[model samples]
Target: MSLSVTKKRSLAALAAACLASVALPATPALAQKVKNKTPAAEASASSVDYVVTIPSVEAVQSSMDEATITDILSGNLAGNAAALAELDATSITIPEITVTLDVEVDGETERGTLTLSNLVLEDVSDGVATSMRLNGSSFATPEGNADMGTISAENVNLAAILGIYGLVDAGASREMQTLYTDFLVGGGSFSSDEFSCDIGAISGGEVRGRPFETSFVEIISIAQSMEDNPEDISPELLGKFVRMYADLLTAFESSEFTFDGLDCAGTTDEGEALAISVAGITMAGMSPGIYPQLSFDGLSIVADDGTMALENFTLKQFDLSSVIATLEAAPELVEESWFEANGRGLIPAFEGFSFSGLSMDIEDQDNEGERIIADVAEFDLSLGQYLNGIPSALDTWARGLRVDLPEDSEDEQVQQLLALGITTIDAGFRIAAAWNADTNTIDVEEVSMSGVDLASVALKGTIANATEALFSLDMDEAMTAGMGMAVKALSVDVVDSGLSDIVLAVVSAEQKVDPKTLRPVFAGLAEGTVVGMMAGVADAAKLGSALSSFIAGKAKSLNISVEAKDDPGLSLEDFMMAEDDPTTLLGKVNIDASAK
Candidate 1:
């Protein structure tokens, strides 16, 4: 499933607040007999006194065979729960368990095997396994291979899972539910001709997937009993499902998951090699619809084309409650890209997202050996104050930036920098905006981009009558209504330090003239264009003089603004109406300019 940016954070926030994914601690395994003193050596290495390990548990054994458990798990939860609880074995240990299957590789069927050893389920009583452990595993195929260490879970309750299965099959009793109080994985890795990945230990606690009997069982049963079509599910039933699911999420007193680390490498179809590593990932304090927190630490990716890294990342207050409501209303939308439907704001409304210590090295695919590198100390975005299901206030910031230009480049941008003898840029960027619901306007308070020893440009503007229709998800509706919105006012300021001198030198060289001689000539042309463009709209000469002064090096800054002569503002409709004779309306718009 493709996720919105906010949901992607949720997925990465521990690979889907995978607190819901806290498995039975089953690690990726290879299909070979593990050689060692004991595969359970790590689990047994703990304080527990383990029983003797059997040479192997034959799958042929009818009732007691380990493979039988897999069948019972899927056949009927109602009987399986009781059958498992009745197992006479106080503790069972198996030396090896091998599984075989055929999987497609490169569009061809290839046989694969996964052999696991040191399997132990200890203290099975009252349908609860005090602990379960699988120590070693190796899986192999012609196309790939994988190996893993001990994967263990403690306090596995057969009852915790049966309840959910019971709802689906109508055979499992509430007592047949499943839950594993705690889980842990030593570590593992897998590889194929195309790619490879290494995973660090994963762990979590209070992983209870079964829902409360009163909270969700009835709704689940009703849904399960219905035909598989969303149309067949009543609005009330869909609403119930969403509510019950959310209730199930809220019922969890505690649930958390963490991925200690990850390192992966692969070759793209283009044959470009890529490597990625992440130090740690974690998600905690999760609730249905809204997740309290998810974070990533020390992530880096390198490829033939580019390299990117970040010291840390965090997402807070991830919310998908709005989408849930959509699902409840039009269940069919869920079958489509429902999250993107009209009025569904941002899929999941994330309160904020931020990253620190970021660096990027970008290489031009078309230009061999040419690249741009930069390091950014921090970047942040925050959203809040809802209007028309949209966040009225949106703020963005990026600071402590340093950029390096590739040397000896053929790119025009590079040549311009070289003309100014600029190989690097120290810069920062920021934007702030908010919606004025009372005024029906969107105020762009500021938008700024600046570089040290370079130059700075800033803008402030507003969009009037930015109503709900303007923010509608329907493109045609929004576009039609948008054309009616007024372009209220706009202001721009360009300030130069040494950048003016560099510009003059570059222009002089391009014109084959002296820098001192080009300044006035260039400034004159700029003034003339400004004066002619609007037919003396709002003191054009004064604005032209300001531009001329700055371009001629008589000033270091130029400020300009535009406003419609009519009181409220000028809309896109007005522009379109004037398209046939735009020059006729030029004098109606006022322009103001100045310099210092």
Candidate 2:
């Protein structure tokens, strides 16, 4: 089984499940209702294999985004602003839209191709099974360092998979419908069954950071269900589900979501070695009742040297219970919220919903100035777990969320880089929330690195310059319980230092450098402008310049006392409560870096 095939099945089932969950009127009943008016009947339905070709996939995507997706049942805009925006943004420009499905629910398979030039409302509103096939796609930049070229898929199937439209009025139908199809690719010879294997490379676009050589095989399967299956389903529910599925498909087809370099060495028009690859894969899907799990295996991205860049690059496991939960709960939540907010209204008032628990790993190497920089980065993530709840209500009030973090609990690759002279190494930044509504907030706890080798660097003009200074900070919490609303509290402390060449040369061997660990110790001793100017970006020169001014102002009154006894340090309990509800604790924090 291939990851692509698995995704196909996973997505197909997902689409089916999503569609089935949204209740809709019987297809025949709705069709008859709109047939009374002759012009409406002709305009509202058609049985042509709908095919639309764009100059490029982007054009198709652009069109999807810009066009208003009317409610096929009601012919109204559906009052779904987000839906409108999403569809408007994903218009794709495909080379051709071919409908080649001939089914009779009997024992015979008939087939023919339907060419679609212009995609209008009538075709979709007719409830026809339209399959779309993508042949080629291209993306380029002027200088082209970041250019991706040539994406082609032959005889692609896109019937209900793409979605059908009905044209009546806004309040006519409260649901949408979809048909499902699965595409399979093989090399030896086309299979008699819809899904059978062939020996050949997958034919598609060339993505960077992926290996697509060795005659690897490719397959694409699709299946769909209507949005009118659940009992008492409404338009609001239908719209939300369709929008979610559409967004998922759009993401899978997007630059950010697609893996790069299937043939890792493919060249651009201007010619630069492609940096990634993931091809020669197979895909499939299966449903087992309550929840569906799609697994991928035998997936690899090989480099020019025959080395597998993604040796273990496979969907080893996937547990979508939370995702399933969200899908099931969203409609109910939307309906309840809408009615509560607007008095039994059917308008889709989309609150927010998200699925968390996702984990994956990738192993690869890239040519850094001189080294291959070989290693693996992995992560295990749970949305509602790691981030119990952020410090803001806005974070929780979102429509969707996704997160990608460093998979390796111990990011050895980064540590290896830091060990080398890569002082500015890119650390694995943890990704938690991917909220789609309003303000989105991400968190970065701290960076880890070894600091021993950097003890001798010197600043040309500052005070007795210091050398190696390795520091790490521990945060208590970014969010916590307050008097009422969610509250946020953060604490940062710095430690660790080694002498620079200048400082080492000036101090006597008998004088230990540890005592001078505090940079503020020297700054505190200063008298004038220095103390007042310490709240911004600081450099040795700036500190030096401000010292004299700081010494002049508070030198006499400066207090420098340290208590040897430990008494729980200092308490700012008075300031904690005010973090969220300012009326209670007062939004203030006491500064106490000193331990005595």
Candidate 3:
């Protein structure tokens, strides 16, 4: 049935009842019929009913005073007393409101359908406002979840949120007053399921605020203002505010957050305008620790008319439960004691980290220079249980780590280095180490690098008393407790003919220097001269010349070894601070050199 026809019939029935009351007088037959129909049966007969109204701001405000409105908007009255009280105390106005509800009854079931054509909240003292509209909203029976359809909102200012919580301050700047979210359109359904509620993707929307140097500073400033006033604020609530500020600071200080698949722009406090848009952003397993597992996918940044981007970046596996727990317990903390207790309490625990497919291309518009591009294929760092009072190990490796040099390089130093057999350099390094608490030692199982080797080289060593020296924080004692401190072997195998010739050329050039001519200059110095007294140069020169000739003529592949003699362990302090001849410090150690 048409709504207009239903409305006409209702009005006609009311006119008939009025005429009967005046002319026919009250009849027992009419009263019997009215009493015969039950309220539910009567409502059922009417089936679908529609009500349309344009409610004024004052009317809306008065309606919010109703218990049902108050309960629905501000949870339960008992637990949300503060919110209810705030609602009653604050002055709110709606410039325009149009609501349409189509309520229907079938058997014992009742359903409500709502469509909002326009909604505007204005006349706020803080100059904040909002406008929203919804189409085809449906309510489930028995006060169940509402299913929203194509909802849109505009001019959702931050001040409105603050004002709702009674946090609006008149002294705040316009920037703080004017910061707002742009138009957003989304739809979602609320149901009785864990994490099932989903707000559909936003096609396009942005939240903007006054360009402050940092969000941390701005939030802290607002918190400080509230602290100074202390009106209507409980100590516990204040502590919570401080705690949130501290968490924000800690997160910003510790982690690198990457954003992708977002359209963003902002102005810095220094008045520099910046803008960036990306395909998407992924920050995986971020935590407040020294080693946080994080990742970014398809990231891009636009700056100074140029772009820097990465395909994927990741840091793997670390626990941040301690940090989160500390932050969550802020409300129970004593006021004015938060900073003192947590300022230096950060301890990081991490498992692994990695990076891959990073690239950058930058252009200097001001200088009209060529675009500079650089790329990296992969980089990774991994750790196994360190510093948690557990046995720990570490492994790191990298591949295809290179930089693209400009065809016409601008820097003279870079060009010079490239000229000397260094072009489009590729390099990689690998390190593996383990800590043994039982033996109090750190065993470096392997340390190797490529692209800087005349021959394949590997270094293996152990730091004796590693646990005590590192964890005990007593350098002097650790230096004097050296034990079993000797290199087991030192060897190198020439793998490239060109690198072998370079080594031979360097040694032969050194041998060609006239040792006799170099000896006289040191020999002519007096016994008390600065050079003679400082280094014993006259006696060292003769020994150095003989050793140089021996190395140049006999050394094909070099090896060296040192064993602790039958004496006390070497004292690092004595070796560094000794004022006597340098060789005197080596008297307590044995040395061997060989060439084969």
In candidate 2, what are the lDDT values of residues 1-596, reduced to their tens digit?
00101111122222221231111111101110111113343332212111122222223323333233222112222233224322322233323322232322233433333333222221121222123333322221122211112222222212222222211122322232222222212222122211222234333331111111110111111111221234455555454553354223212210112222132234434543233333444322322111112222234433333333333333322333333333434442355444343321222222223222222223333422222332333332333321111211122211111222223324576554433323332222222333222222223232222133222111111011111110101122222211112112223322223323233323423365543343345555542343343333223234444443233222211112222122222134533644765443211222222211
Q: What is the lDDT of residue 379 in candidate 1?
A: 90
The lDDT per prediction is 0.66, 0.27, 0.43
Using Cα atoms with residue i matched to residue i, what is each candidate's TM-score against the true structure?
A: 0.66, 0.28, 0.44
Total clashing pairs in model 2 = 90
User: In model 1, what lDDT does residue 147 have?
Assistant: 82
The TM-score ranking, best first, is 1, 3, 2
Give the lDDT ranking, best first.
1, 3, 2
Q: What C-alpha RMSD separates each model from the true structure?
A: 11.3, 21.1, 21.2
Best by TM-score: 1
lDDT of 1 by residue, 1-596 (tens): 11111111111122211221222334342111111112354321111111111234433223355544543321222334546544544676656655554433334555666577777777776556789888978878787898877888888765444344332232433332337767788888989999999989988886645445442335435444342344565555554565455445443434788989889999988999999999999888565566677789999999877889999998867666765454445552233243345445435677888999998888766777776678989899999875446677999988888877777777798777876889888888889999887888889988999888878899999878787787676779888877778877889999887887887778778879889998898899999997888654668899989999999889988899987778468877677878887776566677889999
- For model 2 the local lDDT of residue 134 reads 30
Model 1: lDDT to the true structure: 0.66
Task: Report the C-alpha lDDT of model 3 over 1-596, residue by residue, as the tens digit.
Answer: 01111121232222222221111111101110111123444442333333323343332443144333222221122233323223321333323222232333344434443333323333322233344333324443344454544443455443333432223332333232222333333444555322123334233233333322223224444444463345555566566565564454333211233332444555445655555544544444223333344555666676665677777767675555445555556666345566456532333346666777777777845436777666667777777654422226888877666766655777887785455445565556678888777976667776766554434344555544455444322445545444333232222222231344444444446768554344344324422242333353233344343334333433334333333344333445545545665666444444444344
Give the C-alpha miss distance for residue 461 in model 2, angstroms: 39
True-vs-predicted CA distance for residue 570, candidate 2, Å: 12
